[model samples]
Target: MDFIQQKDLSCFNTLGLKSWAKNYISLCNETDLKGVLGLLKSGAPYFILGGGSNVVLSEQIDQIVVHNQLKGINLVQESASEWLVEAAAGEIWHDFVVYCIQQGWYGLENLALIPGTVGAAPVQNIGAYGVELKDRLDSVLAYDPLTQTERVFNNGQCCFAYRDSLFKHEEGKGLIITAVRFRLPKQWTPVLSYPDLQQYESLQPGLTAQAILEAVCDIRRRKLPDPKVTGNAGSFFKNPVIPAQQYWPLKQQFPDLVAYEQPNDCYKLAAGWMIDQCGWKGRQLGNAGVHARQALVIINTGKACAADITAIAKAIANDVMNKFGVLLEPEPVFVGAGY
Candidate 1:
């Protein structure tokens, strides 16, 4: 483990926001974790960070940043029709998905190009192109900081909601994920359920895992801004889910409302459409602005502070709520001072 004081966290986060942490340590294994935890016990507040894709550091973090760098991959189990692959907490998510597809494994191809780590996947229940991580997750290994014990949680235990999981909830706080296991199909048909995905399929009749991955990548490339070039999280807010009865009345007021009804009698409304309708797309406020192509994403044009970005996001949410009567929830975890 390499420990440093007054560490610059600009390179660690995808947003490229300049922030400082009181102390930072990168843990490569379980043994390294023990030593790091010792520092935490010695009266240091700490935060566990993975790929740093889904977070926005609002201010200088006075706490210790424990960068989860544990890495490894192994086949835990296999059968004629399926296999279970286990990955450490720090493994890059998109790269792992591509690896599985290369091995002829199915299920994760639709989720290709998502930025983050294996441990963070379960926290957000990351999804794309009509497929969610919960569908492939076997279990997750996490260490409870309070209990000081390792626990394994199965699919049902995850309590997955749209773009959320137990880890994002109150009961699962202070648990640092160590690894995750996924059950993947040996033979399967690709899912082209989303409207864009279906249209892409029409262009190419038969598709495999690699083809689906390429399509997803292409779609994302055209829609979302690349974090490397533009400082932005994939989507700033989640698609709001509301009761079916509430959705229809809102739809009546706005006939162009985009929504999908879930099996549980709820409607998931398109956040991007709402933001775009409110005339926020491509709109700029100093260094902070909504991505020209994707209204759901808020970007930092070099000099924007975390507060500026948060202010812009809040304004978008307020405008959407005023127009559509639907409240928008931020997708990224806000650390330090919040909006």
Candidate 2:
């Protein structure tokens, strides 16, 4: 219920961009969540921030920033085939993944080590190692500020597809996610479809869920930079999925193009490889630079502003388009004005 004026959010976001909000509120529970109804009804502009992992904030935000701090974990149901678990929107996503593994519940191992909160998960439809949140999600509890009513969205209603869901579209806008319910399979299988995880099947005598979790965490740690040490928002762009008609011609042009076969005769071209080919990896434009180890990442070499990060990203996207004719889309949500 307590609101602070002109709050600095440099540390709140992983990118470490210097952003200031006219007002800020940290909602720790449902009681605190309802306390801001007056502000909502008063027609004040606002933004909901959770974990601040997948967002880009401008230097100055002309809105009230609500920080979701709600936290709890509960066992909702248990069946012969599945286990229904619910987690508060504000819980750290990585910790929740580890907790599920510890409880002997499986199915979310492939999604381990992803940054952000449970609320932000569905918004981005987070995925890794061939598994996505939609694969395990059952339902989501969200409060629609537009109507000031709560609704439960079933898996089908969520309309999940490649790093996206209903939460990103018009119908789900301004809706505050309260909690997420996951229907994890009791009978589990390790998802090692990705080339990196394929090696683990031979390395471990009997591949276990814990091993997969650890391996995923290790792979991410080795590949991506920790925002604590170097400011970053992880992968900067989504791999472009092109049709066969377009893929074959590009393949003929670039024999070394890194790509994988997708469903419906489509191909998912590796965005990192394309960026590297453009000679931007480990290169800096102003204070923003592409990570030397991972070309998909845009790092704030320290003291970089939103504009600096935006500059390098635009340069990289532009270069990729000119060379490959593929449009690269940024994965993270760019917030505020002048993005």
Among these predictions, the greatest lDDT belongs to 2
Q: For each candidate, what is the lDDT?
A: 0.87, 0.90
Q: Candidate 2 lDDT, tens digit per residue, 1-339?
A: 878989999999999998998889988877887887656766677788999998889888887898988899999999999999999999999999999999998889888888899999999999999899998999999887656778999999999999888988878857789899999988787888888998654447577899899999888999999999999998999999999999999999999999999999999999999999999999999988999999999999988878998899999999999999999999988878544
Q: Estimate each model's TM-score.
A: 0.96, 0.97
CA shift of 99, model 2, Å: 0.7
Backbone clashes, candidate 1: 0
- lDDT for 252 in candidate 2 is 98
- In every candidate, how many clashes are there? 0, 0
